[model samples]
Target: MAMPFFNNMLALLGAIGFWPSVVYFPVEMTIARLNIKKRSLKWLGLESLNFICFLLTLASASAAVRQITQALGQYKPFMYKA
Candidate 1:
């Protein structure tokens, strides 16, 4: 029972981690397929900046959740006091 729950959780995290890159790939491919050229550097730069921001945000949020869980674990004994 516990193993299945753990596996499901891991799978969920994997999907969340995988989606942004998966989404970016097809859109980039489609852009290339369209044969559009002579794009502005400003637009490309901004897109790259946005992608970096997204990855950082996800990473920070995951870190914060982990930290909160760790803190709760520390406080568990105190909660059981009579």
Candidate 2:
């Protein structure tokens, strides 16, 4: 159903290399003429930073989701006293 498709898209977006691939576009274009080694190094550094940012964002989002879910799940039975 639509839920599964949406979940799959999220998972794909959250994959480790996804953001780097998106962020690397400008770097790739700029360095298209560089020697192989230099280009590789530049890409490696850019990708590393991109990935780190992506991971931090993902972690924060996950923590927020967890907190929201925990708060939603909290309940007291004292009203019923059973």
Candidate 3:
């Protein structure tokens, strides 16, 4: 159970933490402190970057889910194959 859930848990952690800490907060803070205009090129770029990061996160989570599902059928507890 725990073994199968490891990847899912990792995906959840990254989705929850990576965006806010790595992209969202820093980008928003930079915009706010610099007074970037709403529709300006720089603002658009930053927002786009944020969106890209979000997509990456989504893709990773989906991949993890896919991997777990595929492995689940063959999963055997404490049965090591050399």
Candidate 4:
């Protein structure tokens, strides 16, 4: 009973964690591009670094949810001997 609930909760968490990057990355890149004065290599490097960090965070959250779900699925309830 609780297993399904936990799986659903994990799925929801993963979705929540993933969506912001999907929506924010393009907007962030656009803003960064627009604000750059001269398109220097330094500014491009910083933007790429920021995007990489965001990708790492999103990947970590997704992997965590996957691991937790798999762990939960393997759990067995202990039965008492009468």
Candidate 5:
């Protein structure tokens, strides 16, 4: 019964929890702690990393949604297909 809501909600929750925790906060803290100058090479690199991580998270979430949709079509609650 809950399977329909499980994967997407899990992905949504994970992205909500992990995006800021893993990506934004750490990068912001690093910039503040080290005082990386704006527009400098190091700052650009860190920002690039931040953007990449964001892209990855977006990709993962989209993949989860896609998989959920695919499985939902093939699935029936409390039934076995294989």
Candidate 6:
């Protein structure tokens, strides 16, 4: 029933939550670091933007994980009316 939907939702959430950290942040940070080493003025702005993006990604990941955990905790096999 809803279990399949929840499972799919969890997978999607995990992908969205982890992809930034795994892919985007590292690449951006590396570029920023290279710019810094080269003494490029754009490095400052790039680093700042990277920081902001990191924070946003972190928040999203945290919320997604929290939601997944809450859903898992509240899951029930069956419900019966009293």
In model 4, the Cα lDDT at residue 56 comes to 71
Off by over 4 Å in 6: 2-40, 78-82
* lDDT tens per residue, model 4, 46-76: 5676666667767777776777777677666
List of clashing residue pairs for candidate 1: none
Rank list by TM-score: 5, 3, 6, 4, 1, 2
In order, the Cα lDDT scores of the candidates are 0.56, 0.55, 0.82, 0.63, 0.83, 0.65
- In candidate 4, stretches whose alpha carbon ends up further than 4 angstroms from where it belongs are 1-38, 77-82
* lDDT digits (tens) for residues 1-74 of candidate 3: 45856766677677767777998889999999999999999999999998999888788777777776877778
Return the lDDT, model 1, position 27: 51
Cα lDDT for residue 48, model 3? 97
TM-scores, one per candidate: 0.44, 0.44, 0.76, 0.46, 0.76, 0.54
Evaluate model 6: give its lDDT: 0.65
How many steric clashes between backbone atoms does each model show? 0, 0, 0, 0, 0, 0
Give the runs in model 5 whose Cα sits over 4 Å from its true position. 1-12
Deviation of model 3 at 72, angstroms: 1.8
Per-residue lDDT of 1-82 in model 5, one digit per residue for the tens?
6575586768867866677799989999999999999999999999999999888888887877787788778877887555
**Cα lDDT of model 1 by residue, 1-82, tens digit:** 2232344346446646663666566556655676545356644754575577567657755765675565555553324434
Ranking by lDDT, best first? 5, 3, 6, 4, 1, 2
Which candidate comes out best when scored by lDDT? 5
Clashes of 3: 0
Q: Which residue pairs collide, candidate 4?
A: none
lDDT for 5 in candidate 6 is 38
Candidate 4 TM-score over all chains jointly = 0.46
